[model samples]
Each structure stands twice: as structure tokens, then as C-alpha cells.
Target: MVLRPHGGEKVRLMVVGRKRLPDAERHERHWGFVEAIADSAKDLEKGLRAQSYGTRTRGERTQPAARPAGEGVYAVTLEDGQMHLSFALELPAKPGEVQKAFRIAPEASYALSIKNPEKGKPVNAGLREEDEADYPRRLQEEFRGRRFAREDVRLLDFEGAEFILIGARSNPEAEYGLDLDTHDEDYQHAEVIRRLRMVKSRHPIKPLFEGRWA
Candidate 1:
């Protein structure tokens, strides 16, 4: 398997098939890869930074978004019984929280080194819909009316979690991973397009994409 780092949004695992597996199984395995990559990235970041005192003292080297088959990012190709996975570290394009941590005006990007597992990866599987559906309004209090930042980050995290949990509960042989079709295809595609447009719209910024058909 080959692992290449795309940029910062996600690690792409490309799975080519003589034949595509069942939808549920295929989705589960795909997410299994994402969880593996995300977990390794998290562990490595923590180990390298050492946040014993907790809070803001340690650097924030969090994993970026987890999306299946997108572009200008790393691609994991799975064909002929072999798998290739790619990894990349991404940051906000402009000066912001990430830049503050790096102590530069958002100009520098670093490579995050992490290890992988021989077998497949484990995913969060997440809390049930009933478990945290109420979180959004609650989280609003934390941000204290900072709508843009909250909308940008929290909405993606929470909605995606709910969707994952619902899928896990419904699918008996399922693993916790991202399956875009679990949500509305047309809407999800539009949303992804929006994100791509946002990234591309940045001044003097070039565009990146993967999994165009996906």
C-alpha cells in the first residue's frame, strides 16, 4: 500500500476494484482507513507536543477533515489485493488560530510524521443520535455568539457524528466510517462543492481535488 500526503484537508485512500463490494461493506472499509489515519495522526501529534500540563500549553496538531475520494490530496489506491494510502497536513489558508500556534503569519506548513497499522483501522463509531443531538445549541453558549467560526467547524463535526452513529446502528455488519451516500447525495455533493469553491476562491490560491467521481 502507498501512503501519500495530499495537503491538509484529508488523507485519500483510493480503492480500485475488479468488482465493487456491497455498499455497506465498502463504506465500512473505507472509513476504517480514515479512522486509522486519523488515530495515528492524533497520537503522533500528542506524543510530539507533550501536553502534560493540558490546555493551550501544548501545540495543536489536530487532524484535518476526513473525506472519501477528493482531490489535490493524497490518494490511497486499492487494487489487486494491495492498498496505497496517502497522508498530508493541512492548515487554514490565512492568519488564524492555526497560524497563532505556528507563530508565523500562516506562511509555513509542516509535515506530520505518523505510523500505521498492518491490519485495518478502528473508528469512533460515535455516540447515538439521541446521545448528543442537543449539543449544537449548547455549544452556541461556548462560542458566545461567534457564529462564523462556530458554523464553520461545529456544524460539520456534529452533523457528521450524528450521521455516522445512525448508520452504525442500522447496519449490522458495519464499521464506523464515512459513507457520503448515507446522507443525501445531491446535497452532500453541493456541500463538498461549496467547500471546494471556498478553498479555490481564496486570493492567489490554486485549487486541489481528489475523488472527482466519488
Candidate 2:
């Protein structure tokens, strides 16, 4: 598995890692990881709203459509000043059912926490700290030396949740059709309208873009 920031700009911060889940039940555990992040971000945004200080003001939640079978990605944004912090997750199944774990760029020094059934656990992997000067060298060393990426699978009762804190990753990708510089009110207004519709619905429905504020 390889990890790189997407769109090749400042730091898109995307992880193209792989995992394995054979049946439908196993897949749901992975999905739960996505869900837990959404729920957690929502709760955080609400708290930010209540504080109304340097706290997050407007926010949006979105869950993109499922990618191919066993592939999922999620993103959330907290509108803070001129910058928005985006948190995202990507999950893909690999081969075998034996448990194996891999950590990518763990030493990059950002607040890291896990939100799963157990909740709030610190991830003490070697890569979680930020070694500023050696980052680029470290990234190449880790990726180049790997003869094969570790892919593990298991009957996971809980696949666990992945939580990431992010600053705006260089404006929305142009493909998303968002013009960040224009300051268009229509886009923001439309988002709010759509979110209202979703919130009013009684059923459990996932948005095309989850964890984004309207």
C-alpha cells in the first residue's frame, strides 16, 4: 500500500492503504470506522457552535459515495476563518484474513486519536511525530525499502475508527466545481438548503458528501 497527498499540491494528505474483509459482515466493520468519524465530527462541530469563540463556526459533513467494492473514503470540513480543516479516511481491502497493521507517516506530529467501540485511544506508533527536517527523506526511505506492503485480514468484530485532524488541503479540488476565490454565496446557500432536507428526513440516509456543513 502507498500513501501520498492527493492532487499534488501543498499536502493533499491521502492514504492509499489496503486491508482485507471477505464477507459482508467484515465489510460493515470497516464502514463503521467511517460512520464513527462522521458522528464524532458532528458532535465536535456542535460543541464548536456552542462555544462561538475561536471555535469552528459554519461546518459541513459529507460522505462520498462508496468507491469500488471494499473501497470507501470520507471527508469533513470545519470552516474556520479563511481556512477550513478537513478530515478524511480511505479504506480498501487487501488479501488474506491474517491480522497485520501498517502505519504511514506516523511521525508527522499532529493530534492523533482513535474513536472506536472502546473510544479515545492514543496511537503510539513510531510515525506519529513530526521530524520536520527529515520528513521528505523519511517518506522515501519507508516507501522505497518495502519489498511488499503488509496486508492483513481478520474476522474483526470491530475494525476500529480512524480520526484525522486537517487544515484546508489547498482549496477544494477543481473537479468538485467549487470556486474558492469567488466567494459565491449561492454555493453556500444551496448547501444549507440540501442539509436542511437531509436533517428533516426520518430515515438513515447518507449524503453524497458527508460531514460537510451546508
User: What are the lDDT scores of the predictions, listed in order?
Assistant: 0.25, 0.23
Instruction: Give the alpha carbon lDDT tens digit for every residue of 1-214 in model 2.
Output: 1111233111121222234321221222221122211212223223212122232664654433222111122222223311221222222222111212221110111212222222223465212223111223433243234321111111011113233322223224332333322222322243322222323233222222222224
Considering every candidate listed, which one attains the maximal lDDT? 1
**Candidate 1: how large is its RMSD?**
18.9
- Mark the 10 consecutive residues where model 2 has the least summed lDDT: 148-157
Off by over 4 Å in 1: 1-55, 60-125, 128-131, 134-197, 201-214
In model 2, which runs have C-alpha deviations exceeding 4 angstroms? 1-33, 36-160, 166-182, 186-188, 195-214
Q: Could you give me the TM-score of model 2 versus the true structure?
A: 0.19
Error of 1 at 54 (Å): 9.9
lDDT of 1 by residue, 1-214 (tens): 1122333443222222221211321223212111112322223222222233434766555533322222112222322332222222232223343223322221111111111111112365433334432344554454344322212223222322221100112222121231212222332243333343322322112112211221
Query: What is the TM-score of candidate 1?
Result: 0.19
lDDT of 2: 0.23
Per-structure clash totals for the candidates = 15, 25
Q: After aligning candidate 2 to the native by TM-score, how far in Å is the CA of 146 from where it should be?
A: 12
